[model samples]
Target: MAVAAPQTSEGQPPKIKASAASLIDVGSGQIYFQKEGDKRREPASLTKIMTAILAIEKGDLKDVVTVRKRAAAVSMGQDIGLKSGDKLYLEDLLKAALMYSANDSTVAIGEHIAGEHDLFVKMMNDKAKSLGMKNTNFANTNGFHHPNHYTTANDLAILTSYALQNETFAKIVSTEEAVITWLPDEESKSVTENGEEKPLKQRTIHSTNRLLRSDYQGINGVKTGTTPRAGNCLVASAAREGRQLAVVILNSNNRWNDATRLLDYGFKEVRPVVLAEKDELVTELEVREGLEKRVSLVALERLEVYVPRIEVEKIQRKVVLTPAPEAPVKRGDKLGKMKFYLDDKELGAVDLVANQDVDRLSWFKRLFDKS
Candidate 1:
């Protein structure tokens, strides 16, 4: 279930200059603010976010990819200047693609992962559909402007939230700078007299998102994009005191300022409240025919809810557990869920699990007990 956007006492949301924009709570996916968030606009290099997701999930980082002719020929937008037959680790290309918005790196990654550019693009569309990005589409691996290549700020926020869940993806986007090595082309690979291969060349790539370099507190990631048709686009994310927020700005004249102001508004509107801690006991469940008649159920993870400042006192929690189960129950077995609510509306839920093992009682013991 979706949580409604919190109402702010501050009257109006921040004035965002972007043609399309959205600010979302990373944990609960609550929309804090929006400006024509569903309007379709060219994503430009921001499309690399989806490409990075597919590559990380579907391709091996250690795998070596040989740049093809098509990738080498790409000269539009920012690129690492890949040459045909040049080799690089999938990991390096990912860094270049995400941090620097390298167009050629995306093409090579798409070709390497799916063996065809169009097929990889199809995968991108399929993944978008699965993520419930109803207003998004992909026409190319690199976010070069295409007539059909477009997405909304709301959709991009959804994509970024999902991407940040992956440890590798989160790490890559938050990186301010990184160095990637690639084998030199044959023309530059001249061997020494002893026939030893020369060391691979390294290129340093810096993040295109300027907010990462700014004094903005807790600013971490995500990506930046620009093109003649797309104007300027940014997906900026930040985490502070266990609460994470992301803002998407598309076709903006001042994306950095817009993102910062919107994020500030978001942080001011809601505050994080830790309702349950990891391994903290919430309730107990009865176990039938077990050596232990009851088993303690604890929160599998921390449950921190971001509530509006005005509604913090009104928040409530509900624990729903399964009926008595016949043991042998293992530690960490999922038994039920702990749900959060605002008034009558459901906010979110977390799994409740067994805190310890519970073995079934022996038949002889059960029979004697009955007597």
Candidate 2:
């Protein structure tokens, strides 16, 4: 089935049935498809994605946390088998929280990080604000239903993109299954025949995201959520040939189907095209009063952008250079700018820089040349 991406001025997008959905080209930050993307709704366990990322950032993985009573008492339907007084590393707790949608584990992480779950919720909201998630708010760390707790598909997509930039967060969500070992408490570390501490017990769990295990190509991680209010929701990421896409679906009966369809459509409908390559000579401009008669201008950085596959040829390029830059120009001197547009609307721009240094002519030579 086809899912409509955002309608470009040049082409029509396909139609989709999800209540709220968004698809982005992860590499170029291009919105391929979106339907009510900014409308807020309960995110369910998908809230744990933000929780996991924060824990990874603020806590040391090796630190062992003694599970608190409140953490073990989260609202039902999910758990990491955590009990009050049980000890587990921060890393293991995060693994359980993200992969298994473990509400208890998520609470344990929140409590450990903020000394209380409510405080951690504040942190989530604060981070959301800082990340420009205007439509997002958090009332709990584990996504237990609270009318105040909500996020939008667009916000979740933004969160996923930011979290994936952290290697640790990305690695954790991408994991299909992980063996979490809980460090035994002092009470449980009774002396054996040799009087040595017993090895920690291990529990293996699989990711809640079935796309990771399915035949879907390049499926990585992200998360899935379900609640009476939110229905089935999913934030999924996939990559091919170095190009990546993130899809978010909220309140959908066919979340998996919708997410996969959006990704499949994105790869076919839009692709990244290099507008300008770094250090590639763009234009040669006359250099006034320099050792050399001319200087080559080049792009200071690579300029790659995403465009609808069919409209790649329609992109317009304009070079705007500084008016007559006098020489003794340095190799990296900013000389001008390259602006890109589609249908007269600006897409992006990059700096044009000097390709190489050009020293001024000696005084004697300058005088002789002038004569």
Candidate 1 accuracy as lDDT: 0.88
Tell how far residue 208 is off in model 2, in angstroms.
1.3
Report the lDDT tens digits of candidate 2 across residue range 1-371.
23333433334444555799998766556566789988888899989988988988899999898899998776597787777888999999998988888989988999999998889989999999998889999998878889899999888888888888788888888999899887877666755798887656778899989889888888888888988888988999998988888998898887877888778778777767899898888998788789888889989999888777766888999999887767689888888999999878577899988888999988888889889
List TM-scores for all candidates, in order. Answer: 0.73, 0.80
- Model 1, 1-371: lDDT tens per residue? 11123333454566767999998888778776778988898999989999999999999999999999999999987899999988999999999999999999999999999999999999999999999999999999988878999999999999998898899999999999999898766677857789998656788889887877777888889999999899988999999878889999999998888888778777876667787789998899999888999999999998776766666677788889898888899999999999988767677788999999999889998888789
Give the true-structure RMSD of model 1: 7.4
The clash numbers for all candidates, in the given order, read 0, 3
lDDT of 2: 0.84
lDDT of each: 0.88, 0.84
